[model samples]
Target: MDLNSVYQRLNTGSKKWSQYPEDVLPMWVADMDFPVAPPIMQALKNRLEHPLLGYSVAQDTLRQTLVEHLARRYGWHVQPQDLVFLPGVEPGVNMALNTLAPPGSGVVVQTPNYSPLLSAPANWKLPRVDLPLQADANGEYPTDIAALQHALLSARTFLLSNPHNPMGKVFDREELQAIGDACVRHDVLIVSDEIHADILFDGRRHTPVASLSAEIADRSVTLMSASKAWNIAGMKTAFAIIQNADLRERFNAGRLGLVDSVNALGLEATHAAYSQGEAWLQQVNAYLQDNRDYLAHAIKNRFPGVRMHLPQSTYLAWLDCSALDIQHPQAFFLREAKVALSDGLEFGEDCGQFVRLNFGCPRPMLEEALARMERSLQPPA
Candidate 1:
């Protein structure tokens, strides 16, 4: 895995590259710039040799692999029958909302969440209740348990992003326990997105909220995938773990002919990822941590106008450009610096001054982006 080598994705129809002009550096999307793990690539190649591309289902081996993975990595034991395959986590979320939530009921979601999670409730005409997570002096975002309980009063389902996106906040055991207890108290179903579970930094362990107790497990739909960690988002495969058979059946029914079966290659790659991609993932995490530190240092020393907290997980960094006095930081960088970043407004209404940067690239590319951004902020001669 030569992560330092920059691959050319310019003419490859890549979403990250194609979204911006030729001159602009795109550090916006959640996907990484590195190549897929060797094992995943080999699995896909082997699967292609079969010469049949029809509708597919997950094999028993794949389920067992995932079951072993969860138990070994997170110490979260789940039966093989608990998994429900899906095309993506977003659809799983919408499915949970459509089937589990009463029509026109409120859905509780933390503010500044991934755009899809933030907007999924509206797709089913469910009201969205926002519970904001604020950063403390140490730059850690802690859940407001009291506020969460209050919000759950008006909501029937809770949309959670564990190892959260945009802000890159990872919830600890205590926080997750509080959240699960509150949901259990209020009878609110938990729809958690744990897609980035395997990408933690600094030896942090991931805890599935449902794994805390049987009571929580009965009422939770936890969605996960290897896409984010393995750089295989293009495969478009994810799964949900529903311990309650009744809830699993209802969630599968909510597909409504819109969400189809998982991709054939995705399933093969997923099995390979869980079984043999750990070494590759470990290296990627270390590289990302270094990139994160470099970016944080650059922001502090070069771009004084920009403020950012060190992300606990994932390769995305939430940058606060409030001090720069820029009305729209995303647009400003795109126009003046030729650097494309995810606009904060998409995550939350009050995040207009913020922009999310993806640090999952070669070190040279990260340095180049920082250089361009620093030059863009310089005072006129």
Candidate 2:
């Protein structure tokens, strides 16, 4: 329960930090600067203390931990038999693309999504069906069911990023129901990448499309992990919940063993994080909320031209840098500003004038980052 010691003991082997050793700051990658939960660390260490690390078989304890966590956190009851293990959510995306769609078909996804979903279709020879997120009165990104319905006939699957990656829009239950109805109507499988389901803000909540209705759940393959929340992504383990027995059988038939065997240590860490991480998670969520507020206010007051939304869920802040009249504002931020952010253009042309900022860091680190950004916007001397 003491997080201060864990913070001090935060490892230096993190790719997001160590990759740029001498740099003042590194916020390009999605990994958090904070330490993993003490319980998770202790669990991983205990597993390491066991000399022989062999292939892991899912135990009752691990399965029950996930089931109980889901029931308590989001009210979704996922049976242990309905699970399929994967290395990461990205692998699940790839597997979904490979399994659900016919060879060389289209897959529908909203723009400004995680960059990998855009390529999952292309890499698997599935044509990219772009359903750009329509901006609402609040300027928040939302699922466009109308565009999706129009495109569904030609597409085989609808890849959803619930608690969407960059924008962090936790689609409300109604919005999800509408999207789910559209997918079911089109006979399309809804493969939801719900990696951030546990990261929603105070007012917002993550409603897994599968949990909306039996019809939707039957057609959905919900992907999730403890990596984002617990900061153990290097462990490379994730879970897939597929409800429909027939669909599950078909969907997993194409497994090339890309991620069947997860690290034993990763499993232990996951079990601990899910089973005993409530208090730690509560603190981290509050910290993230503060970070979200700081970034939004700082950007608005310091750089008036920039448009940034405080994510209702994830730690990422999607910025609309369109007011900056540069060729590629994201590239300018990286090269001139020395703040490497994710290029929105990479996610989709629809978000061409945008950038994704990782604000999951110490407050001081984020302050320094925002200051550099403010200086970057200054005119020539």
Candidate 3:
């Protein structure tokens, strides 16, 4: 089957592409500009053919699949009892914050990060503790161990975004362990948002925070989803993995009200994706790798005064356009450049000079966006 045509079908009502207008290119939202795997489509269709949509239960096959997927991909032994289903990763974040931390406690998130990390805390009346990543002059996110320990000394919770959003630096294993140790020392619970673990490019490995140690595992809540990789964000399915019995019980406390049933179609899609989508996954990863490399080359070789980090994992490219300085560069690009990239302000304070461009589209689409950007950044002679 032709994949490009499949992706084009996604544009009918795609939040990532078609929402703005067919003419306006969308390199903004996290949803992939690709078609989901064939097996997933077949599974969803097969389930719908059953005719009776009913309440769902996590079958043993599915639980064992989760176990094997984790063990194989991440080396984490996740017990079936430790798993809790949620409507989405966002809701899972709120459930963890409300259940684990009392009101007024801070949820420490390293910024510039996924904005939902900022919003989840505020929506729950939990103060957000920002420990902004310290990047070198070249614009790479180097984990600051000292600052992390400082943040955890009182924050009580850390929302760690592995393969961090905006900035594409995959937090190294040693860095993850150091941060996990700090959480252990400060008695802070770590809730890792690891939705992008599957989309890593080149040879970068995603180290789950819980996989570092038994102690860290006991205190960590790992959230993952098929949405980001499979372009199924609207499917409304995500899982929370709690390894420790205490953490599991704690997470379940107020989760009764917060939890929503997993839709039948979503469950089928997930099972199919995990069980039969490996080949498709390889193709997607390879395609995204090329996309990342192409954008990296374009930015480094063609565009000057614009710095972008070639992410090892997610499709997000964090472009440092501070040197361009066109008065809120994110807005200028949207208005003048007619390109809609995510503003860095959405990730954190005082980082508005940056913009996150999604490079998960077809290479042709990306080339056009880059051409548009180049024309916009050119100085008037």
Summed backbone clashes in each candidate are 0, 0, 0
On lDDT, who's better, 1 or 3? Answer: 1
TM-score of each: 0.99, 0.94, 0.94
**Model 1 C-alpha lDDT per residue in residues 1-381, reported as the tens digit of each score:** 889999999998899999988999999999899999999999999999999999999999999999999999888899999999999999999999999998999999999999999999999999999999998787788999999999999999999999999888889999999999999999999999999998989888899999999999999999999999999999999999999999999999998999998899999999999999999999999999999999999999988889998998999999999999988999999999999999999999999999999999999999999999988988888
- List candidate 2 stretches off by more than 4 Å: 1-11, 18-21
Q: Candidate 2's residue-wise lDDT over 1-381, tens digit each?
A: 333232422255766755543543576778877777888888878887879987886688888888887778779888988887777889888887787777878888887678888788888878888888867898877777777789898887999998888888888998899999998898898989999888868767778889888999989999999988877788888988998988788778867766476778788888988988878888888888988988888887888778898788888988888887777888787777777777888778767789888887778778878888888888889
Worst 10 residues of 3 by lDDT: 1-10
Instruction: Note the residue pairs that clash in candidate 3.
Output: none
Error of 2 at 220 (Å): 0.7
Question: Which of candidates 1 and 2 is the stronger one according to lDDT?
Answer: 1
User: What ordering of candidates by lDDT runs from best to worst?
Assistant: 1, 3, 2
